[model samples]
Target: MAHRALVVRGGWDGHRPIEASDLFLPFLERSGYDVRIESSPAVYADAETMAETDLIVQCITMGEITHEEVSGLRDAVAAGTGFTGWHGGIADSFRASADYLQLVGGQFAAHPGRAPEPSGEPRDDANFLDHVIELTDLGRTHPVTQGLDDFAITTEQYWVLHDDLIDVLATTTHPVRPWHPWRRPLTSPAVWTRDWGAGRIVVTTPGHDPEVLDDPNVRTVIERGMLWATRTASAS
Candidate 1:
């Protein structure tokens, strides 16, 4: 039987949640998963549905999730369902819930707010700036970044607080224009993975927008990461 994948997306229209979720449908289909896209977080309500899924790809940002729903998904993943997402879709989601943050491993603390554009408008476009990501001490070699070179991306170089629990995959040390308020040059992580019970979880800090996901390298890395994070990797 083909594996089932659920994509839940909504919150923060600027991230183009619906469009972002749509971008991955073909990839998942090509990978032989029956992909379902839903804009509502209520997808979390169906306990049987969660149990049936092989993976959950979420693009939700700063959205609400109910207590029962959150618990249901948590239990499902712990019981062996994979979980993965990119950028603000996962890292910056569920800011109000500590349990969610604990599961995901990072939170949106700040973005010094990007520098201004030529039109004198602040380029708040998170995925338009090309920057380098330096690998963390723990990221020299890992499944998600094992053979990858230092890549340049138009996406936001995510400077995140180190979560001791996660295994760093790749990082960027070069300072880009700050998007957060308190500014000082700081090296930042770009990708990482963690384990939740019998399941695997991977989060990429790239893919801030549709265009970023279009990068061949970025797209390939995330696609592979999703597959690796899911439980059916050996079968795939």
Candidate 2:
């Protein structure tokens, strides 16, 4: 039987939720998944549907999720359904729900620009600078990132706030550009995985847009993440 995959997308349109998630559909289909698409987190409230799901790929950014919906989703993942996503979709979703944040293990903090700015806010197109997504020694051996080398991407470099509970797969450093306020460099986890109860979760911070996901390295990471995060047959 094909693995059941659910894609739940919607939220801030600036993240291009539909376009971003659409890019991975062919890969999922070719991988033998019976895919279903939902535009709202409300779908998570259905217990039976959650029970049957083998994997969930979310693409929501800065959205709201009901407590019941989050609870249902949590039950699904804790019971062994795999969950994964990239960029703001997974990392910055459901700002109001601590339960959801605890499940994701990371939150998008900010994407600092090329130089110092008077204030900080989300950047969509202004900050296009080259940065390396460097894989760690363990990442070189992990299933989701093994065989992948550090790659350069000229896009938004994510600065995420996360707990040490996750296994860091890759990292990117934020250097102090001339006149920048911070005196030193800061590094953030660019890719990671979390084991939640009986399930696995994956997150990649580089896919800020389809253009970034178009990078072979980033695309491969996300594709592998989906497969690696999928629930095992014994999970039920």
Tens digit per residue, CA lDDT, model 2, 91-199: 9999989999999899998887765346865545667778999999989999999999998889989998999899999999999878567889999999999999989
lDDT of 1 by residue, 1-236 (tens): 88899999999897898898788899899889998888877887789888888899999988888877788778877877889999889988878877788887777665544565668755446335567765665555666666667777666666676578887777665454454444566666678888888888888888878988898767766888788878755422
Which numbered prediction scores highest in lDDT against the true structure? 2
Model 1 global lDDT (CA atoms, 0 to 1): 0.78
TM-score of each: 0.87, 0.95
Candidate 2: the clashing residue pairs are none
The numbered model that scores best in TM-score is 2
